[model samples]
Structure formats: C-alpha cells, structure tokens
Target: MTRLTATAENQSLCTLSRDGSACSTAKYHEGAIAALAQARRALTAAEPGADPDDPIRAVRARWVGQAGAGTTGAAWRAYLEGGRDGLDILLAPAGTSTGPAAGTPPSATGPTAAGERAPGPASRVLVGSAAAGRLGGGRWPRRRVTATAVLTPALFAVLVAAGGGFPAAAPWTVLVALVAVAAAATLATYLPGPGKGRRPALGCSPCAAMAAMTVLAAAWFLQAAPHQPSMAAAALAAVGFGLLQRLTQTDASCAS
Candidate 1:
C-alpha cells in the first residue's frame, strides 16, 4: 500500500508539470500573434509608397514586432541600432528616384528635406527680414528692463541722500521703491517653500533692509503729524519689526 501511494504522487507531479508547460506555450504564441498584427499596421502607416517586397520594409516590420513585445535594456539598444540601419536603406539614393517614380525625391520646386516650402526670392527676403526683426525686438527690451530694475533704485537712493531731505527726492524715491517692492514680491512667489518641519514664511536680508528704509522714509513723510515720533523711536520700531519677522519664521519651522 505504501508503494502504491508513492507511485500515485509521482503521476500527479508529472501531470501538473505537463499542464504548466502547455499554458506557458499558449501565452507565448498569443503574444507573438499580437506583435505580428501591430507590425503589419505600423509598416503600412509609416511608408504608404514602400514596396511590399522591399527588404528595408521587412526589416522594419520585424523590429516593430520585437519592440511591441517589450524588448529590454540591451535588447532595446540592439533593436534601435537595427531600426536606424533599416531607415538608412529607405533613405538611400538607390531606394528613391528624383523623377517620376513611386519613391522619387521631391523636386527642387517642392519642399526641401528641411521642410521649407519652395520660396521665391522676394518671399525669402521677407522671411529673413521678419526673423531679424523678431530677434532684435524681443532681446533689446528685456535687457533694458533688467538694467532699469537694478540701477534705478540704487541711483535714486543716492540722489535722495545727497539732497539731504526726503521732500526734494520723494517723487523719484517713491517710484523706485514701488518698483523694488514689486520685484521682491515676484521673486518670493517663485521661491521654493521651506522644507517639511521648517518655516513657511519667506525672508530676505535685502527685503528686511528695504523695509527698514521704508519705515524711515515714511517717518520723514509724516514730519508734519501732530504727534510725530522721534528718529530713535522710528529706528527702534524698524529693528523690532525685523526681529519679529525672524522669530515668526523660527516658530513656524518648529511647529512644522
């Protein structure tokens, strides 16, 4: 009885092995059929004028099937290399005619390989002129805007200090100040958010300095106020605000 049970177990193992092999073979053949169908569709789409008997077309079809089967790293590299060789065949002079033939190269009167349509002398000159105009027009304004943004504020500040009073420099100073503020805002918007468990607030030394100067300028503007603060008081307020901004950033980072 023990020997008979052992024999039965051996037969069951053989049957399972045979079934697994058959399933694997069926899957492989299904994949091959799908790949072949895809290759036929792609070859027809890529070159409508190509000959059915063309050797290059046959090579490309084979590559399309293999690629569809999901070739991997090294296999993919080899497939691409083979595909390029196939393209070369199709593009070679022997595969094409310049005259009245199915694979004929386009005439000089037609589009070039660069896809430029046949152009008359006048049209060519117009295209060149338009391209040049676009190039110069776009670049010059950008350079001018950048130079003005950087230089205008510094120069205005110097002029105001040299004048020894805020009223005399108020107009130009205000204009430059507003421009600087807008630029700072734009830059802050694009900056990356602080890391997780870090600060959400943005801070810049230059911005802090600008805020301090603005406070001073505002005090000067309000010199005629019925109750005006002293210069020392104004300076202290500026320093307090700067410190507050820094502390707030630290607290936010800790919370995160």
Candidate 2:
C-alpha cells in the first residue's frame, strides 16, 4: 500500500507538470496570433492594396499609434502610404517583439534577450530612396548659385576697399543693387513652370562680368576726376556691376 501510494503521487506530479507546459505553449501561441492579427488589420485599414506580408507596410502600419493601436483610419493610411520605401519598412524590428506599448513606459534598454539588444528607434534602417527623392537632385545647383550671389558682392566690397577707393556712396549703391539682384535671382529659382528660355537676359553672365569691370573702371574714373565724392560714386557703380553680373550668372545657370 505504501508503494502504491508513492506511485500514485508520482503520476499526479507528472500530470501537473504536463498541464503547466501545455498552458505555457498555448499562451505563447495566442500572443503570436494576436500580434500577427493586429499587424494585418493595421495594414488593411491604412493601405487598401498593401500586403500584410510586406515588411515596409507592416512597420509603417505599426508606427501609426502608441501600442500599435492607431485611433484613426487616416493615421494608419498616411503612415502606410507615406513616402517611405520598402527597404525602409523591412529593416524595422517586429512591433510585438520590441518597443513600449501604448501607455506603457518606454523600455529602459529596449527588448533584451540575454546580452543581445534589439534595434532601437534610432537604429532602425530607413527607406533611402523616398528621402532622397523628396530632397530633389536640383538642390545642389540651386545652392551653388545662391552661394555665388551672396559671396560676389562681398568680394567686390573687399576689392574696392583694398584698392584704396572706399567711397561713402558706394555702400548705399551696392546695397540697392544687391537687393534687386537677390530678388531677381530668387524669382528665377523658385518661380514655377518651364523656364522662359536660356537667353542672355535671363542668363546674366555678361551682366555679371561687366559689373566686375565697371567697379574697377569707376575707381579709376574717380581717381582721374580728382573729386573724393566722384570716386565714391564710381565705387558704388562697381558694386552695382558686380551684383548684376552675379544675378545674370545665376539665372543662366538655372536655365541651363
């Protein structure tokens, strides 16, 4: 009877252990299913045509709200349909496997498995093409012209001062010309529609070169005139010429 009772107790313990293991497995499976279902629902609501299996769509869908539970359909749609590319979406970590859920405190060090750290928000790979495309290839060209426009007048001012011909009137005249040229250059760069053509008037290269020469000429003319004010006036003309030249060059480059 003692042996039989001991055997029965052992059987009961084994049964309990088996039941506990089954419950644990069932809970894990349920969690996975729930996560996957949530991901699918998010994709369907946001992008009508997006595949649930698509990693980009999946990540974007997950990002719509805190705890992966976006309130508005529009929010989900925007996230999924936004300019990010497929590769960007794919590189993000699984939403269920990482990050703080909505209303939950952010993970101190994110999801950890022993010593391995899951990718954090900053570490996730982005869709490069979407970002690149939005920036546009024309930015460099536009920036170059802008730099030239700003620098050319300053260069002329320095040259005039160094040449021992700093006329009082020159500063005001140069200021006015700078304002006008900057305005025109800005218009040429940003005004919509196809350009009006690559004609010299719009291109302004000759105008820029001429302006440089005019400044030097004006200085010489004032020196010859033997009048200090006249010299100042000549310096001013040089400044105007330089500004005009820059404007024209920018316009030309933009058109081309």
Candidate 3:
C-alpha cells in the first residue's frame, strides 16, 4: 500500500484507543518516510497530465523538496514533531487536504478564500464516513478485545466461587504459573491484528482448545481437596481461556 494509505489505516486503528496515540514508533517512522518518498517521486516525475496548481500536491512537493534526500530528518520533523495526526491530515484525500503543511493560509483566490469552508456539520459527516469505512473494512478489533477482557475476569470470578475460595496458603510457584499464563494470554490477544473481511460466524474449536488447556494446566499443577477445583486453579484456567479468545478471534477474522 502507498504510505498515505497505510498511514490512514494506522490512524484508523489509533481511533480505537482513548489517548488517540496508539500506533508504534516504528510504524509511524515507516509511514512518514514512505509518504516523503511518495511526495518526492510525484514532484520529480515527468508527467504532462499532472495538475500543477493543486494546493495539496504543491504543499507536499515543497515539503519533500525542502527535505531533500535526508529521509530520517524529514520523517522526524514532518511526523513525530508535528504528531501522527498531522500525517493523517496529509493523507486525507486530495480535496480534503489538511496537514502539518496545511498551516499556510490559502491563496486569496482559492476555495477557502471563496467562502467555501465546510460548516460544523461537515466535520460530523467526515467522522461518520471514517466510522463506516472502518466497519466495512473489518479493521476494528474492539469487539474481540472487549469480550476477552470482560469474560476473563468473569470466568475467574465464577471459578473462584465454585472452588469455595482461594487458599491463603497457596504456593508461590502456583501463583507464578498463574501470572505467567495470564501474561501469555494477554500477549496473544494483540499480536496479530484483525484484517479486512466480514467476520465469520463464531466457531467452537478455539474456545474448546482454550478451555482444555486452562483446565489441564490447573488440574496438573494445583493441589485441590477431593473433587473440588482450587480457586487459584480456576483463576489460571480462566485467564488462559479469556485472553486467548482474542487471539483466536483475530485469526479467525483474518482467515474469513
């Protein structure tokens, strides 16, 4: 994908988070460099058909020209210092262009100066458009993450109740193992993100596998009286089952 397209995708993902700053540094840097390359190439290309007066194109061309061949410095200044949102603005399709370089006032005879500024409702329209695009693309993984987070804690609570209560004297080794399992599950949830496609109907194999793994691990390691499962055992199993679901769902969505 073009850097602009990839950067747009990355920014779409960032919207899922509250802080509005979730994409990794590596991805941001990569996108910025690629975007600069795009601008540079467009500027250098010998094309008779390309418009010379397109403001967005002009701004990008100028920025890339000023940056020259030093992509590292350009990437840092154009993206990191100004913020990834600025890149998002730049990536905004040509006519909707706004970005770090967009701060320069529009020319006196340009669209903005001709009393064509969009009203407040136009901003809402853009937001809705963005939301629809994300949904149609199946790029949002919020459902998977939310479900796992909620279910994991609930499963633990249920298991604890069924087991009567956690023994105050549980071994440190068992606690360590439980923590490790939880960490593993959490890690699994986020590694492979969702892809573009319709979400398939929920399947059972992953859920079954997660449940089995959790139960077996608990059964093998946790010492319990008679037939009753230990609270710690239940907690360990729940963590594995709950967290792993996110990873499984992500894989399944991608497969579909």
Candidate models: Cα lDDT each: 0.34, 0.36, 0.39
Clashing pairs in model 2, backbone N/Cα/C closer than 3 A: 67-102, 88-127, 203-248, 203-252, 204-248, 207-245, 208-245, 211-241, 215-238
Better of 1 and 3 by TM-score: 3
- Score candidate 3 by TM-score against the native: 0.26
- Per-model root-mean-square deviation over C-alphas: 26.3, 26.7, 16.6
- Give the residue spans of candidate 3 off by over 4 A: 1-72, 81-188, 196-256
After aligning candidate 3 to the native by TM-score, how far in Å is the CA of 113 from where it should be? 18
Model 3 per-residue lDDT tens digits across residues 35-89 = 4333333434526444422433554555545444554542234343233332234
- Report residue 227 deviation for candidate 2 (angstroms): 8.5
Against the true structure, candidate 2 has what lDDT? Answer: 0.36
lDDT of 1 at 162: 36
What is the lDDT, from 0 to 100, of the residue 76 in candidate 2? Answer: 26
User: What is the full ranking by TM-score, best candidate first?
Assistant: 3, 2, 1
* lDDT comparing candidate 3 with the true structure: 0.39
**TM-scores for candidates 1 onward, in order:** 0.17, 0.23, 0.26
Over 4 Å off in model 1, which ranges? 1-19, 53-256
Candidate 2 structure quality by residue, lDDT tens digits, 124-194: 32223222222222233554466557755664454345445444465544543443343334333322212
